[model samples]
Target: MRAIILSGAGRYADPWHPYAETSARLAELVAAAGYDVEVRDDVDAALAALRDDVDLVVVNAGDPDGPVPDGVEADAQVEVDDTALAAAMDRGIGVLAMHASASSLRDYPAFDHAIGARWEPEVSWHPPFGEARVHLVGTHAVCEGLDDFTVEDERYANLRLLEVIEPIAEHEEGGVRHPLVWAREFGRSRLVYDALGHDARSYDSAGHRALLARALEWLSHVPAPTADDRRGAAGPTSAT
Candidate 1:
């Protein structure tokens, strides 16, 4: 299948979270998974590549330095080409909104529908970057053959959930469990968002890397690993 890794910017960039390096690594990761992967930093170029044959669009960018919509105002401004993006998604292209990408394209409510969640400034907060334990919330194929694991990255919280999502990973802190990974459906398309991966180092965790690869496979409707996909999360399985 053909996949695109569109990235370059991230929210409040810093030395520790080099978006370019993270994007490069992720591109290679997806390529290793047997996809004809293309990496681009331009939204128009990426969107332009979404054709009838394109199977997946993985958004890894965030324009924290961008501007808010003409009328809406916010602390950090991250805009996206919601018009073009929503069309592709509605037409059944799989999407993976990773890390800062979830917070991207804030001005467009269409993005909320496409991503299933959006970053709510001030209200949305993350703890100091460190080891975060993400546990499985359901028996979804995206988390197939995966177990709860820990990673060193930004743990996003207080996000504005736009729909009822089937959470796959999360952590509990201060008596509240924040979802770290989730799967949702939009129109004829599917989406998976993993809140981990603050930087290149975040992929060092084997479990995190596996989840990324597996999520792509699931979103693309590729058969997921089934040998041991049933060992985690004591809950009802999807009866599909």
Candidate 2:
């Protein structure tokens, strides 16, 4: 499989600054999985490079703090090249939007159609980053034999989900539980979102690494790879 990681923004991992370091580890993991991986900060270059052969597109960047780059469209930071991105998704490319990415395309409804959710900062909120226990939703391969795990990361709360995505895991903050990991179906492909990696320290968490690794496996295995399609489950099964 081939994958492209789009990252680089002052706010992608805002106030934490983990994208650079953690993204390196992510690339390593992708390489270890035998995928031809390339990392780029230019979304336009990514769109140009993407082809039918490419299996995955990882959006690790979010709304920029300063002016959006030239050749790229932006009405402030709430901007993304939706036409290019949506076209790729329409052609069956898998997507993995990590951390701040949900807030990346907040202004583009077309982008939301593929990503399944949007981060409307005005309404959505998360508490300070801390050690939070994350509960896997079910026995999906993404968390196959894993048990309840904790990670030192931001507990994302109150997201705007345009479509109903399968909740893979969740966490409780201030007595209120919130979904932390999720998967969505877009056209012929699939996308997985993991809210665990807030910074380098969070990535260092053992359970976080396990989930991230499994997430790659899950994202790559698109269109329901096996007979046990977790998408059809009415609710989360027993956690392993």
Candidate 3:
């Protein structure tokens, strides 16, 4: 299977995220999961490369609203066009959106719907970075058989969700639990949003790596819904 990783750069890059480091780690995991991986740091050109032959797209980008490096003007930064990327999804390519990617590709408003969530600047935030406890939730292929694990990473909370996602993993903050990892289908495309992978350290966790491997495997092989299954299915709702 061919997997394309869109590493953050230019307008999609921020000072806080080590996009290259985390993306390299992601490449290792994806390769281990049996994918021929390609990493591209130029967000715009990378999105344009999304074609029918590509099996998966891993989004390891930074928040577009975050602080840029010194001497870089935020407003003046380049905006990306996701035309090919969107069309590819419609053609049934899967997506795995990593941390901070929830806020990436904001130039396309449909991005929120694509990834199933959006990181609202003032509303969505994370606590201090450190070892965090991630609890496995329902029985889903992506997270099934995995135990709760702790890893050094930032715990994102209160992200604005745009769909009824089936959260397979979550983390607690201020006595409230927030979905940290979830799976959903976007039109014909399968999608998984992982709220981990802040840096290489986060990938060091065996549980985290296993989770990602399973996510890749699952994304690679999604069965199309049968006519009978569709007829018996409950319609979409505000929650899963």
| Predicted structure with the largest TM-score when compared to the true one | 3
Candidate 2 backbone overlaps, count:
0
Global lDDT of each candidate: 0.73, 0.71, 0.84
TM-score of each: 0.79, 0.80, 0.89
Alpha-carbon lDDT of model 1: 0.73
Query: What lDDT tens digits, residue by residue, belong to model 1 across residues 1-240?
Result: 988887643332333346678888888878887789887765544564457677788877774545433443334433445566666665677778888877664554555676777777778888899887888778887877888888888888988987889889988879899888999765567888888888877999888888888887778762222334434545566877
Error of 2 at 66 (Å): 7.2
Candidate 1 weakest lDDT stretch, 10 residues: 222-231
User: Once superposed on the true structure, which residue ranges of model 2 sit more than 4 Å away at CA?
Assistant: 10-16, 65-84, 107-110, 223-240
Clashes of each: 0, 0, 0
What is the per-residue lDDT of model 2 for residues 128-165, given as tens digits with 9 covering 90 to 100?
A: 87888889886566778777887787877888878888
Error of 3 at 99 (Å): 0.4
Candidate closest to the true structure, highest lDDT: 3
* Lowest-sum lDDT 10-residue window in model 2: 9-18
For residue 188, model 1's alpha carbon misses the true position, in angstroms, by 1.8
Clash-forming residue pairs, model 3: none
